[model samples]
Target: MKRSHSNTGANPDVRVRMRRLRWTTFSLVAASYMLAFFHRMAPAAIASDLQLAFDASATALGALAATYFYVYTLMQIPTGILADTLGPRRIVTLGGAIAGVGSLLFGYAVTMTEASIGRMLIGLGVSVAFIALLKINAAWFHDRHFGTMVGLTLVLGNIGSVMAAAPLAWVLQFTTWNTVFIVLGGVSFALAVLTWLFVRDHPGEAGLPSLREMDGHEAHPPHEGHWFEGLMTVLRNRYTWPIFWMNLGIGGSFIAFAGLWAVPYLSDVYGMERVAATQHTSLMLAGFAIGAFSVGVLSDRLGRRRPALISTAFVHLLCWLPLVFALPMSLAMSYSLFLLMGLSAGSFTLSWACVKEVNPHALSGMATSVVNTGVFLGTGILQPLVGWTLDRAGTAQGAAAQYRLGILIFFFCVVVGFVGSLRVRETYCRYIS
Candidate 1:
């Protein structure tokens, strides 16, 4: 069993400085991550706007939205390596700058091709945020504090998701989608500058004792300083693949729905106005945001990962039943289910802590990124596939039913993921390292 590290070794003044540095660095990186989250899901709110803007079909809209995931999926492993070696300071700052430029291009895109290019850039830029922020959390906080912080990071990032929902719906009433994206791009650029100026990857760099040097430090990597060695080590772990598949199913399904299809599904199937549907989507995301924190804190307190994760998966799986069967329900009932699904969906974050605990401590970024690749891969493929399904379903009257069918397929994928997750070895809050 691994021991917990003390984070109180530094004197009061130095400790205060370290705490400030930890939050400030985390805040900057998290801000960029928030933007990334925003861009990833923004398409959902503006599906109609985008469709009208380019006269795009459902498939085309999906392709445009999915371009982000395409680049993002391709970049995960490399970004993980970059985060591990090049460090979060550089990776996140560069990512924010690129994301900003992508946002600008996406905003100004008048043609479908141009919009695809912009989405590609946005994907490329923001792909770094998730892995990099995980690396940052690994560096600054105590192991016991790790899951909590990661959950909090998700909470922060999901704020962008929240913004992308009801708020974005509101904003669209007064402003063109292009203007909103352009302003977000500018914000991403500013976050980059702040990140560069204030963030450091390690406490030692800020003149504080490294967490390993603190009292009760228990885990130690068998190896370090070899770049590919760390990545290969993570890749070879038996438990890694199931978690990967789990991510593919869970995160992928969530991305497929919440990122693109959920709003349209609601509006089409239930005849919801855009605002009402967006509010439902927003509640779902809000539930996701809150659930991330609750589950993390609970997982930490109980010092158990697998049971909590499995339980969440089960609940999440159940949430899909209503959508899968297209069970008739009131708006209130639909909203309740969406919120429940969001909360259950957040169990995905626990996988990160699980992977982090089981792998070599030095390879946190590599492990996370490798697992993360599955997430984007799932999204990249499913978004377009669902769109294709919608387009090929035939006849205008049948389109709504077809969209519902796409969602049902996504539900089955989620089941596969949760079952696969059951096969992963439990870490119980202790690193094998």
Candidate 2:
């Protein structure tokens, strides 16, 4: 009887310790994810600065920024595979360190070629973050709460996007953009250290029960097949391809704009100051973060996926129409429109959840990574395409007219994403097969 009582008392302490450890691990990983967002979107806020520093044209600038997405696009599947095999802690730690070194190289780059190489390294390193975070979420959180956790993860990570926008513009007023990347490099190294010291791949690594086991349920079975076979399985699954296309359309266009083109669009077309332009991107990113959180919670609560995804996607489609048409707008109206566009675009976050629910549970990383590759692939294509279009448009057209073609390209992609949302298999927020 005494022994039984002692065991019961010890269990509570263990549970508390487990909870603390998981959150510690999550916080560190999330911090690294924030750096990824910062690196991605920072190029836009400092576009003119880059031009002045490098003596680059619009096409060259686009290529420099797109370099990150190109490498990131290629790395997604491999990162996913590593996340599954190596576990999140080791990969995230290594990723953060490499990203730190990349940032330092970028900060000190003397030419566009050097900067591109640094940017490529940064992309290669940070590409592991989101997939690894998803893997960590799967291990640490309840299945039912996966959507909310993903939403929360995106919300937190988008804070870095927000920082890269108006706040980055503001900081540039006092310091050079080079200084910012250098400081961020130091921060990445610090996070790498923290992650290695505290993060465990799952509760088991910390000597605690799996979440399922703690709930008196069976734990998810480990993947018995080879990792390559498991990846091929995810690729062969018909349900997986739709979300990949959906991400390509929505996630790709959104990042292309916010990451490199939005500030320039506003500045070139509307005569807005850099600070004012960044303000629009900042609000847009904030809306995106909020939208991500809301979509996740609402989808999980309703036990449905298609309705929210379809509705939000339709809204996103409509938001693109105004920009593509170059409609007249006051400052207040412009802000509202950009915010609405971002809020609607937030629906894209559901693609990850949707893809994960349809594929084998053990291959969650690979499955989600496959779709995520679509996002960067789209960005890689569109960023340079927009710049090429803008350069082709030439100064012969007025600045306002110059951007219409680029915005039209964005609108066309969003339409494709909206269509893709219609075909996503409804998993009812669970594994269907």
Candidate 3:
């Protein structure tokens, strides 16, 4: 990988210079990831409009929403390889361009088939962003701070999710959803150009001293393992499987409920207006954003993953119990529980850090991507499955019953995640440093 040099002169205050570089890098990477989140999730924000426009059923809507994940799941390994080999800078630049084009296509799409194609393109384009950002974090930050940094990045990037909720709804009131995507697509293209021009692969390549070097620590070389060998290593590890399954369950359930159905579920079942439902959904994302940052900081501060993971899972399990009963509850109560769900569910963002810690340094990309695969794959399958169950149930009231069943299923998934979390060897006590 090649690096850029802003200046070659020896600095009087090397620490200050390094700090500035780190922040700049963090900001750029976070922005790119935010755009990826925007593209990945924008569909859900406008699901109601899509169903009306296309005159599609709930199952069809779910399938369309899951289209992004379908391609994202398939690209995980390839993205991992690209992140490792080409480095995050170039891969993310390319990804942004692809995503930008896809968004434009989606904006222009008039039919469900066209929309599906656009969604797939958007998925393929943005699929590399998260893993690539993780690769950059591993390159730039100290190992001890890795989990917290990843969590912080997720916190900032998920502002896209927040925007995808009420803000998007507000935007739609002024213009069509298609126009919003068109504008977003153009912004994505510009960001890609900036990434290509400004982002460097690593500190050493940029002719600046690496933090490890500055701190009198040795930097590890890239692992020499082949892709298949790296894959096998990740698969064979007992610790890795637990995190993988944990992500599959926790992330899957979170994405299914919060990302895909929360708004529609509120509107259709709770009898809230679309705008109110979108706002409530935004509140859920706001809770997630806060939780993601908090969990990361606390995990780093406490140096423990299991307690955070287990506690959050338990909270998430409790949140679902109320929804499953579906007794006559105030809208305020439902929103509060949903916020709790988001906060509890956000703990899974720690899974990326966990995956990075358990795998060898050489295979961090592969390990992270593999664990993430379970997340997207599970969402892709479950979103439509939930919708299908509701469709089969017939009436709106019946659909609410079906959704309750889905929540119960999600509760079971949280249990699965809790068990998987326990299976993993606790890494927080043994700092990556």
Top candidate on lDDT is: 2
TM per candidate comes to 0.96, 0.97, 0.94
Q: Indicate the residue-level lDDT of 166 in model 2.
A: 94
What number of clashing residue pairs does each candidate have, in the order they appear?
0, 0, 0
Off by over 4 Å in 3: 1-13, 396-399, 429-433
In model 1, which runs have C-alpha deviations exceeding 4 angstroms? 1-10, 216-225, 396-400
Q: What is the lDDT of candidate 1?
A: 0.86
- Rank ordering of all candidates by TM-score, starting from the highest: 2, 1, 3
RMSD of each: 2.7, 2.4, 3.2
- RMSD of model 1, in Å? 2.7
Off by more than 4 A, model 2: 1-10
Candidate 3 C-alpha lDDT tens digits along 1-433? 3222333223546657666666776677678788777765666678878998889898999899899999999999889878877888888889889888888988999999988998888899889888988887887888878877888888887798888878888888889998988897898899899888777767766666665655555556667867788778888887888888888888887877777787777776788887888777777778888888788888888988878877887787777777677766797887787788788887788888888888887678888999999888888988888888778777746646767766677778777877787776678733352
Residue 37 in candidate 2, Cα distance off native in Å: 0.2
Instruction: List the candidate numbers ranked by lDDT, top first.
Output: 2, 1, 3
lDDT of each: 0.86, 0.91, 0.80
Looking at model 2, the pairs that clash are none
